[model samples]
Target: MLVYSDDYLEVIHRPASSSCILVTFNEMEMQANGSRFWGQRFCEKADFAALGFISRRPNWFPAASIEKAAAATAAILRQASERILYGHSQGGYAALRYRLLLNADVAIAFCPQLSIDPAAVPFDGRFTRHFAPALHADMEIMPEHAAGRAYVFYDPFHAVDRMHAEWIAEKQRETRLLPVHMTGHGTVRAFAGTARGLALIESCRADDVPGLRALARSVRTGAAMRPYQVALTAIARHPAWADRLSARFGNGFSSVERVNFLYHRANRHIRDGELATARDLLVEAMALQPNNLGPARRLQELDARIVRTSRT
Candidate 1:
């Protein structure tokens, strides 16, 4: 059922007999599909009543403002015994940003940015292109915005995401920072459709911190990102291992992961003083991601070193 629709946002409700209700915020649409409700299938499969907040644009759900968005569905949200706000990335920001406005019992945000406003989080330029003065002027997710307990999941190894999660934890005393390492910016993907993901969600809904801790432990070994992280680490430490893994995995890695492996393996070779081997690896990495500046810059540095070495 369509509860609310506006130029900037759409609210759709999937009714169920359960007393609890999950409110989901949609992430930025990469494909520009008309409008999509996040967690639609999961909600249906779990038989949980849910309200999906869909963004009409990648404007970070600022369309009519949080006040107006909440006002539109105040009565319906108030009727639920338990209200949990959930989303990933952009949607995750909205989950925390509107927790107080929506009177949520809990907020689960995965790899959420504290703010995309350049002035607020200049360290992260990844999403700055999407920032607009009119929409993101008041984009910071403050401590007061989190009405109840909030769980922020992010990879600590990802520098930008680490900063965001740390800032959130520092500002919001009630917020729990859960590190799902090695998933990089795609931390949510580690749990998206798996049994452990479902279990983690159930634990969050029940407010079972111990269970969540146990699940977190299990995730370290079973996460979907584990294999990729392992492969990258192995490649970085032992350049010879790259060829062995490549032969074994055989097209199992995505192009991005392959590029990452090549780049890191090249770095290892450079550290080992194998300039020729590093040059070859970097060239391959550049071939994989022609526009990537990391390998390009490294290749330039390598050329300079070679020139200096020959002169010496």
Candidate 2:
């Protein structure tokens, strides 16, 4: 049921008689299409009602500005017996922020932005599009003043996400930081693709921290997690590693993942000043995933550089 809808956000409630409720938030810069959104689909079969929040923008609710929507959401959550929150990226921030307000039991945030305010995260510019709104909003502190425990999932090697997680842990004593290395900022998708996402969610729902930790470690070591392997190759920037990973893993990556693999390998070649190799890799990337614009744009840039160098 659509509980509240406004220009800024939409809150939908899927009521079940179960004792638990899962409150979800949408990622930054993503359009939430009714119940078909990512978080909704992910927790669909769980034995809990779902309260999904679809943000039209990346303002992080701007609590002072959207009092009506916030109040409505609070009312809905306050009625629930046991509430657990789930989200990825910007939605992760919401899952943490409102956990205390709603008195939720647990929060599972994947690669969450603790704060986008320049004052809080002065070095992070990943969300420059929402800077003005974030500045005006209550982006002063990490949402650590909550009652229930929060589990934060992020890649330790990912600079921005690591920084956010570290800061959140530093500020919030009850937070458990899980490092899912090589998954980059898309840990949710990486785990989902591996079919262990539901199990992890269930662990969180049960408040089984040990089980969750074991599952997360399996995500790092599991050979069936093709996307994680592909991401590792991309981060490693080695063509041979990509080839070996592809050979061992077979064609397990999505179309976009394939493009990323090629593009990153191409980028490595470019850095090495192997223009022809980089161009060839980008061409293959475009051929494999023709609709992906990253390789196309990189290809154009490579061609322009080649032309300029030839003229000189």
Candidate 2: the clashing residue pairs are none
- Give the best candidate by TM-score: 1
Worst 10 residues of 2 by lDDT: 223-232
Could you give the C-alpha RMSD of every candidate to the true structure, in order shown? Answer: 3.2, 3.5
Question: How many pairs of residues collide in each model?
Answer: 0, 0
lDDT of 2 by residue, 163-253 (tens): 9888887876578888887677777665764247668766876778888878877876553444544555454655676667766654777
Global local distance difference test of model 1: 0.81
Q: List the residue pairs that clash in candidate 1.
A: none
Model 1, span 238-259: residue lDDT tens: 6566567766773777888877
TM per prediction = 0.83, 0.81
What's the lDDT for candidate 2?
Answer: 0.74
